[model samples]
Target: MAVRSTHSPSKIPTIYQCDSKGRENQTIAADMHGTLLIDRSLFPYFALIAFDVGGILRLLLLLLTAPLAWFLHHFVSESAGIRVLVFASFAGVKVSEIESAANAVLPKHYSEDLHPETWRVLSSCGRKCVLTESPRIMVEPFLKNYLGVDLVLGTEISSWWGVATGFMARGGVLVGEQKAMALRKAFESSLAPEIGIGDSEADFAFMNLCKEKYIVPSEQRVRPVKQVELPKPVIFHDGRLVQKPSPLIALLIIVWFPIGVLLSVSRVLIGSNSPISLFYYIIQLTGCKILVKGTPPPNAKNSRRTGVAFICSHKTVMDPLFVSAVLGRNTTCISYSVSRLTEFLSPIRNCRLTRERSKDAKIIKDILEEGWDLVMCPEGTTCREPYLLRFSSLFAELTDEIVPVAINIRTSMFHGSTARGRKWLDIFFFFMNPLPVYEITFLDKLSPDQTCSAGKSSFDVANNVQEMIGTVLKFKCTKFTRKDKYRMLAGTDGLVGGKPGAVAADKLS
Candidate 1:
């Protein structure tokens, strides 16, 4: 395939000016940024790697270069700015860390930023390729895993002894002419790509190679692709940032971090010491919102021999605390791996589970006999998204009266959940949000017909409770469990090597 560029740099035709898309078996080469994604700036993705892998100090260092990065991006070449970001975020960092961030953190952002029209064009092709100026390591996982792209030819970064050198390879940044040459090299023996899509003059180098080409305009009025529209659902992601962190947002978070820490500590102290009647008021005074919807059933039913089992959706580690507060009585929570510090600070009793079915069941029965309502997060782990993990059937087999409690947490800036970060600081992160909202909905208690005592299998009972909660919160239910969650986020079994899960019993005794 061969084509000529008849238009000037500024006059390149936009996607709106060309045919929408086709379902034919054609090959495509689309620029990753601007062309595929709505945003063209590369700082936020780099900032993710900096904070995720290198910690606070490294993230601050990257932030310090923001002004210079902006100047270089505007005054100098875009590649110059990208180089500065790559070096600041990647220098001396482990190659594994970079790969982890790209795999876990960047995908959510990239999926959210996919250009609607551009995706329609790029996704329709049979063999899709992405050519970008960013490091190949940063963009490959998302493109191949989520978008089903066939090839990704991006700028190569240098590394030594499993650590990034923070410098580009001998081929230099894959922009302008470099992208064009790389494209040719990638398809030297294979059939030439039939179509190309780009946003700017820099992308024209490769876009001119295809028989058909379309330019994505700099300003896109079309809405970015919604989460449901994505080719793959991003069920598991690891990062504290609840939203994409532009330079301004990053600076705001940095400035508020210290103040947020103080507020969080105070709130924790208040929650642990305050009386039940005044707990909600005192906590609300600190700028967090707690909303309880639906009616909470009585602590226990006389018809049931055992205490009521509260099956709650997991979000932050504070789910039990809030659920207990809304019920006007405390519930003994099951902690899988709680910190010693948390145990000492909690007013509610925490019972640790052994993960073995028989041992855990005995523990649950023993706790019930001790005159305490039991709250179990059958999902085992916390999921930030609106999807509920598979429920544990152990709870269903133990109790006849089950209350399905659906909880939703809204954060302004920081997420309170993490699979890779310090699990002990989860409450602190939850409190760090400027105006966090904790919404709790207490569904009707499960009838005897829905219990194991009534001929229903434990598995069926567990699924019923899960479906009830999922319907209340409008969240989808999945078969994924704690092991699946850890494998995706932290590369572990979510146990035998880590902190307790968000709903795991806490020692906050």
Candidate 2:
């Protein structure tokens, strides 16, 4: 007693014709396969009789009832059509039942086209089948690209003489029960549980067949999906992940070079003569004794009016004081300070370069113009270790007689926050410890062709300075290169708090 039709009947056929209870009384039952079987029953029989109403009145009433039925049927059909069309016009699925139906009928690409998150769900599914309105030929080509899915079911497009006819062999109709039937066939013999997603009530029958269901929410109010977080890659400087000193700050160090030297020298010679040698003796007696191995550079007296630029490694704030005290008043040294050109003209007569004016080439030019030799520490800042900072090319801007000097301090205690072996809070305690030995070496001097050049850029000058210092100190001199002492100072900043070789190896490992 099962029925099949193109569409649901407008109404179940009248149970009986003429006789109220005929074969309609038969009993029907459905088995495991959902097929219905019926037991026929006998109907009660009665003699037929005819009854007549007033002829005209009956005719008038029949006319009225026929038009009313027709009007109502048209109204219902139109309403249903509008509803279906409205759902079809939507860009995406909305209702849970409809979404379930669509997913049951579609593949990963189709679901992803609707929403990206569906990719995750589809990937988790062990196996899948796709049912689309498109023809099998069209869908098969696309499915081959994905390759993971097990099956594709779609309309069959009809072609004649290698040209598409206006018709599809299986018809391109993807409506209502058509979608549901395709989903049922795919699931009928499958071991895996089925899942469905759709957007309308028409998909309910298909969705109901699935074990799991997902419905995309309306775009207007859908909660935003959570995104995965990733870590940013770390950047390295000179082959180490260290905070770089700013170019501006380094430039300031160049501008104020003379100032830093003057302040440090003044502190060393607080109550002594203007002669830097007097200050040197005091530092030696104070136990920060510097061991001078090489003779005072051979050309020390050779450069009469020849401007000598003393380029030293920056190890401590006391470096300039030590170098100047050792060199005495014989040469003029540039250190970080304010106003070099102005100060060079004074009676006390030393050059000053302010941090703000580091880029001014005119200042260096004016200093050399006055016939005084220039002294500078190319590693502009005092570092904890025996590393050399890139030198400023402003030295190249000065006369080319560049002298590379190296200062080594054997300290019982290092000072300042820039000092070695002090915690952030304990930095103030560094000066409490007794000072250490100070060793100074005046290495060879070179002419303009040897060190300074207008052809090279400022960065090149910094590199050249590193090379010059490295040559005299007998250590690797690139920006990446570091001595044992520098590694110790780096520890003061909590970088590595042990011996240079061991700590650096551990860090590299």
Candidate 3:
């Protein structure tokens, strides 16, 4: 018999909902929020704190129960049951209230740690299942109502109508070997999992049964163990984004900030003509390597060539600086948007273009006509993924002397992405890192026929150049645009307060 909660339909928890023929239901069985989503045991910790017992009594209860809880958690194979019983004894709280509080707070707490890449994979899968040792009441609302996981299987805490009974149901602890058996029973015809991802040894019982198994490593492990090599990089550590700084590194960054600023100003003042080399020198002092591949074209040496346009793949605000330093050229960079402070402090001559296509075209054409080598990122924004955003074809129509420059940025401590509201911070973090490498390569030039022809539009030219750069850097090409990035970062549709005019004015200034 399936037990149903009296809570609203939206908050109703699904314990074991399966059709008669389980063979037809194929799901990607992921672990719960704390395991697969974030690195936090929210239910247990929050329940202890929010228990109805007085603060001192609660503290005393925890102190008294901790040893027994630890013993039960380790000694017993079905430890989750004992842990739940211990929690229920002193909790003095209704399961409904705890469930309500969990539903209210879980989203806000773990929203940032909700791995976008994981969601991207799961969402593409037709159905996904969550199997966890956490209490079903605690994790159900978030996983079902918010994350939309199709199936959830977790430890069941016995209750009397609407009250806690301080005991787990018989054979209810869904953990370890029991978890493996439950998974097997859920599916008929001896169906096997195609892929399994888990963090701890407890999951090994069922994870080992899969064709492909991935273990997320943690310091809690007894010793260093071999992990399955994944196809792509995973950017998570202990359930949080990978950006924690050690105390010594933090202090070093604080001390290095002023020195970096001084060096930057000195370069701007004394090395303006060859600022690229000076910038390269400054970055090298921070233990970064700048590798430039492929020589510039002979015509690239002629600074007076009107049609010369340096088309670069955007990775960070520092892209143009690296390109200029590598080529030893004074170039004017065109950008759609830039922080006002960054614009003021930048060493290169930068032109902020408006969204007005006609005006931007006129400005770009005039700049090219003035015999100034133009440097522009056709993608218009920085993306941290090794993927190229769709390119703008405006520059392709303006000039045919397009030199596609591939820029690859690597940092040991900080990400070099200059997303919205992080331009100055990105630069600060870029310099703070002990070693940040920037690899620049110049691809073959794009001729007029390749870029813009009667049959092929400027878009074809842009795509062709984008493909060449992606091939060289081994980056994936994505359809996401700068507008998509802005909407994501700023929460507006690439405009502030629905006013593009004000935004354009701010960017121009």
TM-scores, one per candidate: 0.92, 0.36, 0.56
Which digits, one per residue and each the tens of the lDDT, describe model 1 over residues 1-509?
34355457666667766664574688888998888999988888888888889766788899999888788988998878888888899999899988878877888888889999888878778999999999999999889877899999999999999999989988988889899999988887787788788988788888888777788877747688999888768888888888788988888878888898898898888888976556667778888889988887675644344577889999988888888877777779996887777776777878899978899989998877766789888888899887888888898878786888999999988889888778888888898888999999988888888899889999888888888888888888887778777765643324444664343211111
State the lDDT of candidate 2 residue by residue for 271-313, as single tens digits: 1343554656654554345677454543334555555667777
From the highest lDDT down, the ranking of the candidates is 1, 3, 2
lDDT of 2: 0.39
In model 2, the number of clashes is 32
lDDT tens string, model 3, 1-509? 11112222233222112121332344566665434554533333333323322222443454445456556666764474346444634245566655544443333334334543344444445566778776677566556654667777787776676665656666667777767776666654545665455656677676655544554444342221112122212111110112322223334434555675564444334433445547767656546688989876653436445757889998778788778777665678888877776676667889989999999999999988887778899988776656677888898888777899999887654455534224665565565455568899998787556866545688788888888998898776766666655553332323545654211111000
Collision count for each candidate, in order: 7, 32, 2
What's the CA RMSD for each of the models? 5.1, 32.6, 12.8
Q: Give the higher-TM-score candidate: 1 or 2.
A: 1
Give lDDT per model, in order: 0.82, 0.39, 0.59
Better of 2 and 3 by lDDT: 3
Worst 10 residues of 3 by lDDT: 232-241
